[model samples]
Target: MARCGSKACWFGLGMALGAVVGGACAMLVRTATQERVLRQRDAPMVPSDATADQALTVDATDVVEYRGFVIHVFCHALGMGRFKALCDIWESGAVVLEGGGPPTTHVTAEESRSAAIAWARQWVQRNG
Candidate 1:
């Protein structure tokens, strides 16, 4: 019988290697895409007037003081005229609470600020 070291054997080996390499590349791409999405989600929605470090400035006109908490409303663009509202509540220069409202097409800066205030009030009323 002839030896099996023919072109067909090499072709099959090449195909198997190609499949393994392709699968590895696909898995790497999937992992990278998932990590990118997670980073975007965890990123803060910084407003245009925020400081360099994205810190809430007390002098900012958008900053609102409710009860003992200072609420900062940040609007982030979500493409297609949509927006995400983030409410960062601070006490003694430290963020004590963080919350957000439903993403909506309508501008919800004021609504987010109000919600933060209400949350702070309720928290105080319950804790005190």
Candidate 2:
């Protein structure tokens, strides 16, 4: 029969204990994270009255409407060429306009401005 040394036995025991400790630590971390998420979900929903009037934040964006006068909201850089080309080729008199800057939209200033003025007049007549 072979006899095991104290050092070898202690090393094997230490390795086994380390693996168990590591697994327990991993489980503990996962449970803590789940508990935190659950706590957040249980929190109360804030009432609308508690906040300021969100309606005051108006979206002053440009839009082009069609025969039905439906709003076609877009940005300012969608040039006359693409829209007009599309309409001319397709035989559709659809409106195409947008707000300021390159990123906002792609409507050309010349075409968009003309349309914008027309839009303003129409808006005033209808609203007034």
Best by TM-score: 1
lDDT by residue (tens digit), candidate 1, 8-94: 988888899999999999999999999989887435555554454232223332566766777766654443233445566678899
Error (Å) of candidate 2 at residue 22 is 1.4
Clash number for each model: 0, 11
Sliding window of 10 residues with minimal summed lDDT for model 1: 52-61
TM-score of 1: 0.42
User: What residue runs in model 1 are displaced by over 4 Å at the alpha carbon?
Assistant: 1-61, 77-81, 98-105, 108-128
The C-alpha lDDT values of all candidates are 0.58, 0.42
**Candidate 2 residues 12-121, lDDT tens each?**
88899999999999999999999988877324344346433222123324444434343433222222232211111001354332332222222353464455445544
TM-score of each: 0.42, 0.30
